[model samples]
Target: MKKVLLYLKSYWKFALLAALLMGVEVTMDLLQPKLMEKIIDIGIAGMNLDFVLKTCLLMIGITIIGLFGGVGCSIFSTIAAQNIGADLRNDLFAKIQSFSFKNLDELNTGNLITVLTNDINTIQRIIMMGLAMMVRSPLLVIGSFIMAIITIPKLSWIIVLITPIIVAVLLTVNKRVYPLFYKVQQKLDQINTVIQENLAGIRVVKAFVRSNHEKERFRQSNEDYMLANITANQTMAVVMPLMILILNLAIVAVVWFGGIEINQGNLQAGSVIAFINYLMRLLQSLTMLGMVLIDISRATVSANRVENILKIEPTIKADHKQDDTFEIKGQIIFEDVSFSYDEDGEPTLSNLNFTIEAGETVGILGETGSGKSTLIQLIPRLYDVSSGRILIDGRDITEISPKTLRKQIGLVLQEAILFSGTIKENIGFGTGQISDQEMVEAAQIAQAEEFISSFKDSYDSPLSQRGVNLSGGQKQRLSIARTLALKTPILIFDDSTSAVDTKTESLILEALQQKRKDTTNIIIAQRISSIIEADKILVLEDGQITAIGTHQELLTTSKIYQDIYNSQFAKEEKNYA
Candidate 1:
């Protein structure tokens, strides 16, 4: 909580102004009971109607003054709290963006989403409410206690006695509620994970006719979340009634003692009335303090969650200080490169040694779990190799700034991800200051131009989220176009054309062969036909490269290659029949 509150340093002036205004409001509140006592004892008791009217006017004016103070405090507190929230959220997002792929894998997407939105919102709310109530409540309690002592010294003991009891209850509640609220946030993360997975794979669920299963899964998650919330609230619910009971009992004791003093003629009626008023104010402040404890407990948990993300140092760091004069010719060399997702786990890619000359079109072939995707992902430095080195153009990739290296390589993953935007914007997504001709040319190269032209709005046609409105094949083409638009010196296609038909896929490969002949292209494909024309092919099995050769050369020499080609060839012949 202390670390998170450091964001408030930038907005201290606004916060200070809010505290000062609260002081002014509290002063006005403290003066009210004293003024009422003066009116009743001097003006009303002496039958001075003129004095009574004047005192009433003064009280009204004081209330107006206090109203301005209260309103100003609220406005300034909001400004400070909102700015703090904005800064904290922006920093948190920036930190997440810096995280390495390994960090992301461990953190998970759903939990990060919850931390960004729900958890930060909790911190923001508590800050806004705390600024107003925390200051006002404490001041009211102390100020009212002092006024009560001044009004009747004999009854001051009641306040001193009641305060310790209220403090004890608040302390106990804080200890119990913190753990419950932490559990509540964990359950919320679970609910969010279920929703995210269900929504993202909604089509798959429907295709498999598992809608009832998804509903049951969601129902179970929602019930756990609800039960967690109920338990926390049930614990918190004990506070208000317990506080009210203490307040009512204290008030009764005051009234009882005051009446006895009145009969003995030791205390005036006006003084007794003022003392009772001050006592209520003092007790009510304690009640508000109890409420503030709940906010503090919940915010503490949120603060810790937010801080956890902020404190994590990204596993991968790029050397921004590296010289900018070096140029990449796209020649890649993997020297004894090996990687494992876990330190003690089996290697995904093991002792891999290979090289691709600049502008060479290379094919990577592997069966399921052969680490095809993992091999290419290492080139972009998405996940650093656990051992050995990967060099691009004779420079270790780690020595180059990630921003500089990634900009020169265009990578399209197996899954085609598109945002909700116009077709033009999707193609020209990150390549800044691109012209219309460039967008058209890239789309043409990816064979997406024909389908794009069919739309009524053409390039201006809007796409749904993840391009769900487009066919699977169309989405793949657009994903290719988006990467092609970068015109990077190196290109990686991780089975990005699997959804497209053979005709379209062949056209896209032919276009790349013709137009992007000068760029290095690494294509990972399941179908042998997809990479049959490549300059060289790599056959991988169990994290080891089994063979490396051209298409006809591999068919003659490599049995694994032969098995794949024969199986795919047989399937093609059967389809042709």
Candidate 2:
């Protein structure tokens, strides 16, 4: 709540103006009934047509004023709500970007998506509704009560008695409904997760003919989401009818007692009529108050979720004290570094140490689950070292600003991800002002220029979402080209060429050698041919480096490397016959 309040503080001026306009609107509304009472009791009863005409015109003018005020309030509140929602979403996105990979591992992408879209929308609606109703409802309730007392003091007691009862009922409903709404939001996150997964992996689902299974899973999630929403709406549904019933009972009492007063000449017919109007207005405002409470409850829940994200301090923060610029020679050293996903789990890498000089190519080869990716990720500080230090040049990676450190390295993962954009845009993603010549050269180096040129639009051709229009090898080549376009000093290719044929792979390797002679490279691949020419190869087994040597040295010494080489390339070697 405090966090949300702080976020809203920036727009309080607009909120205040909206509140003031709503107050004026309610004041005009409350004044109308009083004027009607005046026309009826003092003008019509006294047979003064002039007084009635004058008062009716005054009422019309007040109504016009109220309408204008209402319109202004609506405009201001809508603007404020939209701005608040935008600011909140921007803050959430910034927070997500700042989080370390370890933090991201704990949050689902789908859940974050829901928070940025659905949850923020919910909170914005609540804020708009709150600003529109908060001041007006209370004014109507209290102003109507005061007018009633002035008109018929005896009848005002009914309002005093019934208002609290209505409030108590609303509070009770709110208490029960808030938790259900919170649960509903959680269930919504799950549904989003399932939908996102299915959309991303629809091809796999169809390939295995598991569409029915996926559908069933979606159905279960959808049903749970539906049930949660129904439960919350149903609980809130009770508040209105019960409020109406209580208001009706209060009306009956007012009429029953006022009739006696009229018979005894204690009250006029005009007062009775005006009192009933005020009673209805009061009841209507109380009902609006109930709705405001409902919105408030839901907003409270959403605000808490948003605040949870905002309050999470990123494990990775830029070192403000350190110089932003460093002469990076790309010398990477890991000194006795150890890491584990969880404290209770065995360490993925323990006491691992290695050093690579600038302008060197190092290959890491290992079976699945051997922490090959984790080992390379440390240099870029994707995940912090759990128990040791990683140095870039002579400076600890942690001591340097993350921006500076990452700007020095370019990474291409095994899974190539492309956003919906043109080929040129994807290649020049980070710094969007690359020259056409630079883009073409990078694509040529990745062996992607020929295919890109095959298209009629070439660089300007539109890419489908995630580059689904491109083949797997094309995507990998484009992803590599995108990395190369950055021209960073240290390049990390995590099985980047796995989808390309040997001929294309050889061309890319040749390009890398010819074009980036001074750059340091780290290659992680399953194919022995992929890393055969690396300056040095590190063999990993069970999260430990088993052999560190050239390929020929490993072939003579390491049985594991020999077997992998023999199985993958021995046939090709024989085919040379």
lDDT scores in order: 0.90, 0.89
Candidate 2 global Cα RMSD: 1.7
Q: Candidate 1, which ten residues in sequence have the lowest lDDT sum?
A: 318-327
RMSD in Å for model 1: 1.5
* Global local distance difference test of model 2: 0.89
Candidate 1 global CA lDDT score: 0.90
- Model 1, 362-473: lDDT tens digits are 9999997999999998998899999999999999988888778888889998999999999998998978667999999999999999999999999999999999999989
What's the true lDDT of residue 453 in model 1? 99
Candidate 1 clashing pairs, residues 3+ apart or interchain: none
Error of 2 at 9 (Å): 2.1
Check candidate 2 and list the clashing pairs: none
TM-score of each: 0.97, 0.96
CA RMSD per model (angstroms): 1.5, 1.7
| Residue ranges of candidate 1 with Cα displaced over 4 Å | none
